[model samples]
Target: MAQPPKGTYEVIHQPNKLKDLVGGPARMDERLIAKAEAALADAVSKIDLAETAKDSIVKLDEAVERLQAEGAEPAGPERTIYTVMHDLRSQGASFGYPMVEKIATSMNRYLELGEPGQRGHNDADAIKAHVDALKAVVATKMKGEAGAIGQQIVAGLYKISRTKSK
Candidate 1:
């Protein structure tokens, strides 16, 4: 077979808007870090993690029920659960709830690995366990590992996930 002619492409470099805006790199001094930390603390304080997470967990529970009703198929509820879990994972750490982040991460992985409609009763139970864990975290306002209890909660969730039948 004759080889097709190679096409030549021109490379274009785009200007760095951020660099232009900031001018140059600045050292992260202690004072700057302190200021940033204070600002972050203030912003974090404004967020009611308990209320927010509880609301999301409620939605997650509803989605879980819908998913179970739909036989764990790919549908609006699955997407809703995934979205809620993702959002929880992202916000959990920032809000000082690392356990929430951990559980949500596990939930997301479960959703990702299991094929729609192929999930079984154990899978739904595992998901429910995740939801329960999240609820416990929010209800207790658990944050920053929560010591042995947090470790146990996360470990228990993993155990449930591992036991899920195909």
Candidate 2:
């Protein structure tokens, strides 16, 4: 049966209309397709789980180095760093490292602050602080919301973010 919204369809299987719909036996049914999809999903999940997450942290560290090197250079390089920081901000929390995400978010804010005077210096020190924060979280294997130390670090970064560095 068709549902409302003009064009919505519910894909269902009707076994009785075997020879009429396709001129032969309906070889594929919803159950078969669903089972196949589930099996594929399971296989893909297994493959995805096999990769070591530590490698990701290593890569992120490398990216931080690149961002630091690009420090307050120009918009192009800074934009690349911004993209990296943005990704880290969104991905870290999902990967069980909320602290990294928090630090990344702060870094993103720092990056978005425009030029140096408006708190958007994008210097090595400012970038390093956030990157180091990420490394700390990963190394310590911290999970969930961070504790006082993390808060302190973030607060420090944010403080610098509000000031101009030129």
Candidate 3:
């Protein structure tokens, strides 16, 4: 696919290119890396435990359900959910997990097409699937085997969060 114009979001899929850009796995002090990894995992776990993702999924589900119940086409909040899903899809691929990026892209496509009947025609199931996939990737990284790629992703997110806070 052609590259997205400057300032526009694009899904990048070349793992080799990403690895090059991110730098190949570098050896580091095991204990220090482990500590950082633990801290990052804790942060992500807290996010999950707060149910922010689950709540988003539930909101979209409810919106779809309400539309179906009312015998009206999905609107308003449902479209907003799709818009959010689209924005998320655009960024997810750059976060280090190709699988997650793929799932998010699929979810975006499904929502863009107006979620067809499968599990009550709700896109929530698809959204949940993407969330679950991302969680799985994070879980693997938390196991200490994700190596440098995982560490970089976590550290980058933390850094971004810190910058935004300031």
- 68-143 per-residue lDDT for model 3 (tens digits): 5645454554565566555444434433344444444555555544333322334444444444544555445333
lDDT of 1 by residue, 1-166 (tens): 9986689767899998988889998677999999999999999989878887767988988877876774455456667777899999989988888999999998877777665444644466678889888998889888788999789889888776666546
C-alpha lDDT score of every prediction, in listed order: 0.80, 0.64, 0.49
Report the Cα lDDT for candidate 1.
0.80
lDDT of 1 at 134: 92
**TM-score for candidate 1:** 0.76
TM-score of candidate 3 to 2 decimals: 0.34
Residue 138 displacement in candidate 3 (angstroms) = 10
| RMSD in angstroms between candidate 1 and the native structure over all alpha carbons | 3.9
Model 2 CA deviation exceeding 4 Å by range? 1-76, 115-122
lDDT of 2 at 64: 50
User: Can you give the TM-score per candidate against the true fold?
Assistant: 0.76, 0.54, 0.34
Between candidates 1 and 3, which one is better according to TM-score?
1
Worst 10 residues of 2 by lDDT: 44-53
Best by lDDT: 1
